[model samples]
Target: MNVCGLDRWLRILVGIILVGLAAAGAIGVWGWIGLIPLLTGLFRWCPLYAIFGFQTCGLAEQKYGS
Candidate 1:
């Protein structure tokens, strides 16, 4: 749950737009990269974030009872 709130929503939105463009043959294969953000947003976890020790979800600890 490192990804949360607005950041998560933006990732989902951008991912959808990019993938949609790819499917429509508008952005070509590059748009396929959008799947990265889409999956991260869906899972609420980002590998890069983990490596960088970054977290956007403030409620993560409380939610998990940590």
Candidate 2:
């Protein structure tokens, strides 16, 4: 995964919680932004990481498929 195990699970958990809170009207509409982490976790890719040459996949050559 582009993100490490801990990071991936945290993102997914936080994303779901935020979205749930938004849907329940307990938070602002800005909570919808949680989708960023949700999708990135599901897809195992982060655009910011790709752009910044960062990765937590535990492999030196994992970034950009280099």
Candidate 3:
């Protein structure tokens, strides 16, 4: 396993903020439900990604290659 840097942290933060704000909105959670995806998007470690082999975070191979 590896640790993530700034990009990963930023993604998590953005997810929390957007989801939190949406859940607080007047129109309510019908649309707020969409925030679930945003939340997952922010965190680079998605379960679906693991299944599909899709990772958006900084490249681990690139790090080691350097």
Instruction: Identify the candidate with maximal lDDT.
Output: 1
lDDT of 2 by residue, 1-66 (tens): 477566777889889999999988899898998898988877778999889977667765354533
Q: What is the lDDT of residue 15 in candidate 1?
A: 97
Worst 10 residues of 3 by lDDT: 1-10
Q: Which residue segments of model 3 deviate by more than 4 Å?
A: 1-3, 30-44, 56-66
Error of 1 at 16 (Å): 0.3
Per-residue lDDT of 36 in model 3: 52
After best superposition, candidate 3 residue 11: deviation in angstroms?
Answer: 2.4
Look at candidate 3 and give me any clashing residue pairs: none
lDDT of 1: 0.88
TM-score of each: 0.89, 0.83, 0.41
lDDT comparing candidate 2 with the true structure: 0.80
lDDT of 1 by residue, 1-66 (tens): 688878888999999999999999998999999999999988889999999999888875439723
Give one digit per residue, the lDDT tens place, for model 3 in 1-66.
122455456656665666676777945666565455555644435566668775654576336621
Q: How badly does each model clash, as a count of residue pairs?
A: 0, 0, 0
Candidate 2 residue 46 Cα shift, in angstroms, is 0.3
> So what's the TM-score on candidate 3?
0.41
